[model samples]
Target: MSENDETNLPVDAFEPNRERVKIDAGAFVQQGNTVYRIAQVLDFESIIGIAVETGRSTPLAVAELRPVATDKEPAAAPDLTEIADPDWREAERRFAAIQPLLGRYMVGRIEVAGRAKEIGVDTATLYRWLQRYRATESVVALIPKKRGWRTGQGRIPTFAEGVIDEVIRDFYLTAQRPSAQKAVIEVLRRCQQHGIDAPSPSTIRARLKAIPERERLRGRGYKEKAKNKFLPAAGNFPNADYPLAVVQIDHTPADIILVDDIHRKPIGRPWITLAIDVYSRMVVGYYLSFDAPSETSVAMCVAQAILPKEEWLLLHKVEAQWPVWGIPRMIHVDNGSDFRSDNFKQSCLAYGINLEFRPVKQPRYGGHIERALGSLLKEIHDLPGTTFSSIKDKEGYDPEKHATMTKTEFEEWLVALICKVYHERRHSTIGMSPLRKWEIGIFGNGEVQGVGLPQRPVDRLTVLLDFLPSFRRTIQTFGVTIEGMTYYAEALRPWINAEDKEAPGKKREFVFRRDPRDISAVWFRDPSLNQYFKIPFANQSLPAMSVWEYDQAKEKLRREGAKALNDVQILQAVTELRGKVEEATERTKKARRQAQRRREHEKNISPAAPILPVRSTPPTPSIASLGLLDIDTEDFGDIA
Candidate 1:
């Protein structure tokens, strides 16, 4: 196939193949198992013997390679320096303990091996140990042992016969119902006390995944859902930031989520909310929701985002004990309703922290929380489970029915476990885990405190308040008038007066100076009142008025209505002049009703006034006899 055709091939058709390439700094590529370092395509064929799986790169794998200093750090000579046998044995013991925890299907074995190398022993040593122990156990047992399948199907599994089942069961429980960090640590500590081997996060993740999907969700037949990422993760640093200044929030709906307390299944999707500290990527607050998350959730998230780590975990314990203070200096939030609420704003004000709203419709704006939720969702639900109930004869029926969920309930638990499982547990992003992230000052919570933004209060507020969009109202009753209401200062009132007919209409504006102490009141001037005064929102409602809206209305009809009413009144007066007075009031009421319906019908099709329902039949009024004034003096407050 042509390179373009290969690129077009379906993703499932793609297979991984490892290849090595000699490439210069910054040029990198990877195929299934091996990543090629190539300065150009020439290096692909000339340098590494491994074949490329595809013309293009597998993004997840390619993301791991860096071309800098591709020259290998010289291989070590056989270690002439002797270490104690016990030291090697301890390393060997740790390796043996987690070997069964590894999954065969996972794509990143090389990455896992890299982590092992960082732990003091290389991947080759670990493999040698697995083989060495197997041979030794066979000799000791005095039996001809059968070979074990690489894939775990029928088992030749146990070297320590009882330990495998026992460890698997305990590991399964943790996977089935993950405990808070404190609880998990306590369990691990207890295991240490009793001389049982404890598992690391990697092992815990893998073993927990081994439980049958149906069993994992505490039900029969459950398949997991996958999510996509818009951006790659940023590299990490141990001491990168100040505390409480930046927090990230994102939404994820839960899946194979709990159906009820006793029966859990993957039924539907739910919105999971989380706030993480930008510096450490430790989840500060989280909630999964079955409903459109409300302001209450936002307030709760703010509270958690600000508190200390251990205390944040206490919130999950049955016997809860935690502090209430420690609110952040500023919180990074999306423009969704929950975060945009007036109540949330007040909370920020009360705590003297700034609430920074992210751009509309962009999830990546809060990348830390966005990425963290994806990791948690994958860990708890998607990675391990493939198909729940795969019986051959059933027609179109998924055996995974028991694992299905409703979106609403999924949202509910998506919110609940955000704190219980995701936040209070260890964080893969920060790496100290959630519990350690707190004690380690990764948040810099106590040592590096958040500083609030300085406020420059302006008295006339129109100039300054306009910057923040306080509130706006129309010029309802022109001229100076107030009922103990505060008005915009006299100086800027004229420039903003809607009654300035000689000047341009677009130039008119109203700005309210919102005081944090008295948010309900804004300052605007009653032009006639010369003195500056404050106006409460109840007394003024200008901000929503739009010239485009009123311009779109039929103004000509308004003038015609005045003329028609005058003409009707004239005829009624003329009839009364001749002492032939008809019940004019009833006729006028009938005309008014007809006019209203006619106006409504014509509204959408055209702005033209409706055909007069009165027609020309039985003319009831004349233009001459309707005694009417042609001036608008409705608000002649001081006019003579």
Candidate 2:
């Protein structure tokens, strides 16, 4: 075996003082190709118990194990080394005065005595100090020692401690509410019967107080109550000094009913993903979707926060300016799956953004974002289709009967209110409006300018495309098939049946990017030239529809007894369902609910989901396919 093999390596393979190679419990060690965590140190420096990934315990020799070192800083050594006992420093100081005389042997005891007198110490004490200082480099060695009985003062015998503990567990710590005085008497009786020394009542009382109240309560079978009563409240989260230092993201269901764009009927409440700058208390960006929170929703919300919104505001007809844009230093989030996803972590790492998760069950860490959501929802409670915030406030109020604004109208209204009203209103905490605070944070107090700077700008489309779901596919004779949809593009013709040179002996599989919102086309990157090409669906006659719409339509048809459903049949079903929802006059509750869901499904799908770099001229079927060229803008499809 090679020397790199951890299990086969000899004891001397590693250096004697390698800092990472620790033998303590809880340290990580590598054996062969597998890494094991040290569960316990069985013998001081000889044997240890290690737990594998599957939690199985295995015995390992200390010499055979090598500790694993990560990018984190090394474990700190004990801090007691620098400090010495009292009088150590004084003794060392006195010794320094007679050092020259002590070095000369010709100088007799009389000279040493004279030197000791000058330092205010007797000859014997001076010699003792010198002897201790020379033997042990630490000055602590010169201090007087606590000898004999002083070490055991006020201490109970081990056997007496055991007897007292037995009496306490059996009598004192029970649900019967036993008297402490009686428990102490019983402990004395038990110790006397066993011929062991009994602790005095005062000593017993002191020990009883030393036992934690929570532990006592738990011993009496009040575990939950004791925990609730004694557990400390979460500490306050420290505020950031500057804007964009830390941002928090959270999702809450909006407290209002929304209507369909076409039919003008009520749909369910939309989920709002809100991002806020903790320092300025300013709303950076938010996304409203009928779909539940997911990785896609998180990606879209982050993209909105990072990119410029001048064009988006104009399109939505909101006149207020929202200038916030930049990658935050760190993002604080809850332990939701969307926040924990690998995709989100990788994306944040790519932009040098740190991800911090709030401790589980600790709401104080995310109080800033939670309070922001609460305030926003409180404002929404006064709207036409308001749910009034809670069951108490919503009692006797019919939200659906009052519902009037469509999803699009609500979006426009929300943006305008956020920018024009909320941004201008004075915040109690900061003593200024969020917009004003942001201005001060970005600009200055008056004289000296702030040190804050905007992050490097990146292409908005590039970020959007990079976040989309990627799939692996081989360039087969039948073009590329994704989710049962075959896509074809003339640019793929030259690379057909090509083998991937990077992975020898493995079938060549290229990565394809897709936006689940619109299944009309997918983007493929040519590995050799490092350029992306869009390939539309094989059939040109099919109507453009969101993935949710198509899936819902297919499921509805299947429930209606249709078999062997095809894309054409599914499209026909979608059209039929849309018409029924729009024209129905007296519908059942179920049908109305289905119609609302359909409306939400369609409304959330954006027409601009995939924002890949576009080109005007097609590839010339020459070296141009392998060469690089600047990209131009082109619209792909709607975002689902």
Best by TM-score: 2
Candidate with best lDDT: 2
Any residue pairs clashing in model 2, and if so which? 7-32, 517-640, 606-639, 607-638
In order of appearance, the predictions have TM-scores of 0.28, 0.55
lDDT agreement with native, every candidate: 0.36, 0.61
Q: Model 2, poorest ten-residue lDDT window?
A: 10-19
Name the regions of candidate 1 deviating beyond 4 angstroms. Answer: 1-240, 260-267, 306-325, 360-364, 382-400, 404-431, 442-640
Q: lDDT by residue for model 1 over 333-402, one digit each (tens)?
A: 7777766755445334323344677656655566666677666665444412213222343345442454
lDDT of candidate 1 vs native?
A: 0.36
lDDT of 2 by residue, 380-427 (tens): 988998998779998999998999877678888888878888888998
